[model samples]
Every structure is written in C-alpha cells, then in structure tokens.
Target: MAADVRLSSLKEWDDDQVLSAMSEGNRLALAELYERYWYVLYRVAFQKTKSSEMAEELVQDLFVQLWQKRASLTVRRVDSYLFGALKYSVIDSIKSRIVHEKFQEYQQFFAPQVDSSTEDQLAYSDLLGTIETELLKLPPKTQEVFRMSRFEGQTIPEISQKLALTDKAVEYHLSKALKLLRTQLRDYSFVWLLISFGQL
Candidate 1:
C-alpha cells in the first residue's frame, strides 16, 4: 500500500515536471502534458455539451488554443488550469447558442421585410441544405476527423490517436474531405470559412 501511494505521488510529480518544462517553452513537454489530459478534458466538455460529438471537438479546440498560447500561459496547478479552460470554453459555447437563438428570433420579427424573391432565396437555402446533407452523408470516420480538427481544435497527431489512424492518414483524409466541402460550398458564402476557426 505504501508503495502504491509512493507510485501515485511519483506519477503526480511526473505531471508537474512536464508542466514546469512546458512553462519554460518546451513544445515537447507541452505535448506530453496535453496528451495526459486530453481525454479528461474531453469528458468534462462532453458532460457539459451532452454530446460525444461536440465534446470531442471541444477538447481538441481547447488544446489547440493552449498550444498556441503556451508561451504566455502560467499555471500554479495544471489540472485546475485545464479544467478552468474547459469550463470557460463550454460556457462560451452555451453563450453562442443563446446569441444564435436571439438572432433567429430577431430575424423572425423582421420576416415581413425578408426578400420576396422566393426563387433566389429558395435556391440559396436549398444549396445550404444540400451541403449539410452531404456533410452528414460522409463516412463516420471522416465526420469524426472533421469535428476533431475544425470544431474541437485538435492537432493532426491527436486526432490520429483518438481515431486510431496514422497522422499521415489523418492529414490525407482531412485534406480530401475539406477540399470537397470547400469546393461544393465555395459559391455559397465566405462566412463558412470563418466557422472553421472555432466551435459554433
């Protein structure tokens, strides 16, 4: 039992040591620290989002953001800092949903002034609907890759492990899938390009 306790303590020190190196701007250390917590962060976000799909994305995005800002990040406790970021990211997602709802309501209020050109509006809406349908029609693995990279914000290596694919394979699949989507939706609007930046 004492040995077990000692082992646990040593495991904790391992995490802290990696974190110390990370704070000193070690990319490899940061990657190790993130991999250690990736699943935990995913679970926390998944619990909040109540969707395995969205949770995966949230975890990915948080780590990407963390990596991008690692040089400036300082934390007294790595676990607490990660969970705090997860909470904030989830809250931000909820707020976005609320804002979207409000915007939809506002649009409904002004429905009378909507463009009366049914042909054009229908065509545009149909195109959007078609794109969404096609996206959903993709293989489950492809969808997961898209969600992890674009929405959750994970790196290629991370996604590769999560889905049990090689990093090179992940990159190829993502590239091909993204190319198809962009080509199909390119004529719609450039705003979808921005959606690739963060979660909706």
Candidate 2:
C-alpha cells in the first residue's frame, strides 16, 4: 500500500517509524516489522505453547491480524503490544482445545451406552460436515498437511519427507490448520456434549 518504500531503508527505521508508515498504508513497513520480531516472538510462544508448530503458527498469524487492524490499531510499544496480543491468543487457543478434548472424552464415554444408531450416525455426519466446511477454507497445502498428520497418522518428519517440505514448514501449515479448525469447531463442541447428555 506504500507509494515508494524500499525494504533496505525500512529495515533501518525504528519500530515507531515503521508503525507510523504502516498507519500511512505502507505494506513494506509491515513486512519489515514482521521480519524484525518474528524470531523473538516465536521463541517466546514456543516456550509457552511447548509445540514448535503452535509457536510458528502463532507468530505468523500475529502479524496477519496486526495488518488487518492496522488502521485502528494504536501501539506505543510494539514489543509490548505484540506480546500482549499473543498472550490472549494463547489463552483462547488453550480454552478452545480444552473444550474439544472434553467433548471427545464425553463421546468416548457415552458411545457404548447410546441406544440409537440413527442419531449417532446423524450426529457424526453433522460434525463431519462442520469440519469439512472449515477445512476447505484453508490453503491446499495446509489441508494436505492436516489430513496427513491427523487422518493418515503421519508424524512431522514423515509429512516433511513426503511433502518435500522442511519440518518447520510442515509445522507452520499444520499449526494453521489445527488453529482454524479448532476455532470453527468451538461452536459445535458444547452442542456435541449436550447431545451426549441427552439434553437435546
């Protein structure tokens, strides 16, 4: 969005200057800012999430959301803002995963007690529909990585060798896919629990 901004010159600008340019619709400045902080953010996120894929995904998407809200965003200290935002994102991710894990556990516990095959099949179909709809919205590579890792039970190293991507690249895509699906599926997660309890 910038009229004329060289990457070389932007690299020399401080965070305040880069943020100012981003507010003025400078795309290159945003990229420069991302390059500046991505590694440190990744390290911090990795420490908290304890997963390489989750850490990479968090750092990558942090800048994406930052760009989306650049016009209304106000940042006095870029580092503080980035870390604060990441902290909340991490909390939301943790909460969403807990909801999902609880639902899966409920399903396993009640699967043997359910008497109605018709309703069970219907519920599964509805759940699968929600999953597929969200999955299709992701990039093709992300889709492939998620399926290979989850459905096909492939490890990161296997996915990397098979897809000819570096392990980090596979982690990034898998992280993205998992995050997106978890967010979307969050809505239906409690409903699945309700069905398990026969409250529906």
Candidate 3:
C-alpha cells in the first residue's frame, strides 16, 4: 500500500500549485496559504497602521474577503496578489482613520460652541429626532441588528449569533441601514454640521 501524502506537504509547494488548489475549493490549501503568509502580511499591516489590533483585524479581513471571493478569483502570482491587496487595505484603513480622527477633533472643537446657542440646541435635538425616525424606518431585522451593534455595543459575531444570521447578512443589513440613513439625512445642513463636528 502506498503512503498517503500529508496535507502539510503542500507547504513545500509553489504559489501556483497552492493557488490552483485554492481555486478548486481546497480548504487545506487555503489554510496553508494563510499560515504561510499571515505573519508577513501582519508585519506589513502593523508597520503601516502602528496598531496591533487594527493590523490584526485588517489582515483577518483580507483573508475573509479572499475566501468569500475565492470562486471567481484568478491569481497568477500569489505573493504579488496578496501583498498588493494588503497594501491597498492598509491605505484604505489609514484613510478611514484619518477621517475619523478629523471628525473627532472637529467635534471636540465645536462641542463647546454648540452648547451655548439655543438655535444650535434645537437643531441638534431635531437631528436626533430625525435619526430616531429614520432608524424606525429600517427593516425590522436591519433595525434590530443596527441597534444591537450601535446602541447595545454588540459585536458583529454576537449580533449574528443572537439573530441567527450569517456574519455577511448582518454586515449587509448594517451597511444598508447606514446607506439609508445617510440618504435620508443628507439634505440636512444642520445634520452635516453636527456630524462634521462629531456631535451626532
């Protein structure tokens, strides 16, 4: 009888072989690829973000996206593909962090000023009312998921398990809710001002 080849042997295989295996829905191949590349990618991400948690999340998210889109993915050079993706992911994460920090700073700068004006107070109150109304307008499941994530401070996995929905479905609903809310509230200048200042 012939000895069976171990999956661990694939670690010695070249990128093309691994990519082909991954394209064929081989979970072992995916695992191998992850094991091989995760540390390098994590290092790159950490160097870029300078936040261990953010770097870890970014790398994990990349793998998740890769798995989710594996069916249609075509890679000639796995190293180039993965490193390129990581680079772009780092760039996007940096951009998002910058925007968030700017918004937070803006909020802190204007928070003191907003409290001094009766008109500003009324506008802020109205904005909150509008946001509540918009939240009510979301689909029941979407609204529940959003509320759990935002109000109850539940993580996506927690919300998914609690609602018996897949993580992707939960994320979809949350994205949809945000899109709708943005659309509904886009026309309000006061809301934009408040948001820019981190008031809302």
Candidate 4:
C-alpha cells in the first residue's frame, strides 16, 4: 500500500519532474513539459514574430520537434534546455523571415512594380546580411542543419534521414546548434526569432 502511494505521488510533478520523465521517453512527460514552457515560448515568439498565429506556430513546432525526439533524449537541466530551445527556435524563425523577405525582394525586382521606399529596405537588407554572416560562423554541420531546416524548410525526420542520423541525434544537434546561436545572438531578438523557427 505504501509503495502504491509512493508510485502515485511520483507520477505527479511540476516542470522539472515532467522534464525528467521526458528525458526517459515518456510522452506524458513531454506533454507536461509543453504545458510548462508553452506560454514562455509563445511570448518569446510573439515578441519576435509579432504575429500571434506565427508565434503559436513556432511554439507548436517546438513541442512537436521535442515529442519527435523524446527517445534517446537527455537533459541536465530542464529550464536551460527549454529556454535555450526557445531562444534558438526564435532566432531561426527570424532568420527564415529575413531570407523570405529577401526572396520577395528578388521577385519584386523582376516584377512590374517595385516599392518606391528604398531606405528601410536597404536597412533591412543590411541587417539580414549581418544575420547571415553570424549563421555562417556556426560549425559546418550545424550550419547545414540550420539551412536545411530554415532555408530548405525540411522536416526533422527528413533531415535525420538525409544526414543518416537518428532522430535523437538530430534533436541533440539542433539543440546544441541553437544553444550556440543563442549565446552568439543573445541581444538580437529579431535574429533569435529567425533562428528559432529554423531550429524546429
């Protein structure tokens, strides 16, 4: 009877407990983790994307990625992992937007009507260039993953298959790569958002 009670008690926990379970490949644990970090990630996404739908998408994507890689996952600290993930995810998203905007600009240049306003466009272009340079500074494999996910918009599974890696390995690489980007682009939310989107 005492053992039963203890087991029941062990089933219930806050963020840290859920994370511990998640590390052990428990779906319920991952769900609990999603509940704990969703709002925080959403806020970060919102700050960067400035679009509720996009922010929601970003959070949703992050959780989905987490779930997909639950097996063979381990974390020393849940808070750091969650926040670091959010930071990287946000940066990836922002960088993707920058890339998309540049593509749009390219298309517009070839189109009939180009925007008359050049100053803001130039500023944004320069900012994007800076962001790209930072991305290039990442390790080659990390850069490849980031580009495949952010630029090519490949799914995690696709990336894993293409790279001949396990799903967990892919997740770890992404998480680690994002951590590096988070540290490098800590001050720039826009840059962070771009990368975060790519991260997922």
* Model 2 TM-score (2 dp): 0.56
RMSD of every candidate to native, in Å, equals 10.4, 12.2, 6.1, 10.5
Where is model 2 poorest over a 10-residue stretch in terms of lDDT?
191-200
The sequence of per-residue lDDT tens digits that candidate 3 reaches over residues 70-183 is: 888978789899999888778756754554565556456544373478877676567668878998988899989876655444556556657889889987887887777777
When 3 and 4 are scored with TM-score, the better candidate is: 3
Using TM-score as the measure, name the better of candidate 1 and candidate 2: 2
lDDT of 4 by residue, 1-200 (tens): 86455345555786667766666766666666776778988897898889999899878877877776677557677777767877766775676566666545544553333564677567656656765787787777877877776556555665776898876877776787787777766766655765575344
Candidates 1 and 3, the one with greater lDDT = 3
176: Cα error in model 3, Å: 13
Tens-digit per-residue lDDT, 54-154, candidate 1: 78877877777677666787777888988998887787666545445544553454334465677756765676576577678777788788766655556
lDDT for each of the candidates? 0.67, 0.74, 0.73, 0.69
| Candidate 1 regions with alpha-carbon error over 4 angstroms | 1-13, 113-200
Candidate 3 local lDDT, residue 189: 56
TM-scores, one per candidate: 0.47, 0.56, 0.61, 0.52
Candidate of highest TM-score: 3
Cα shift from native, residue 200, model 2 (Å): 23
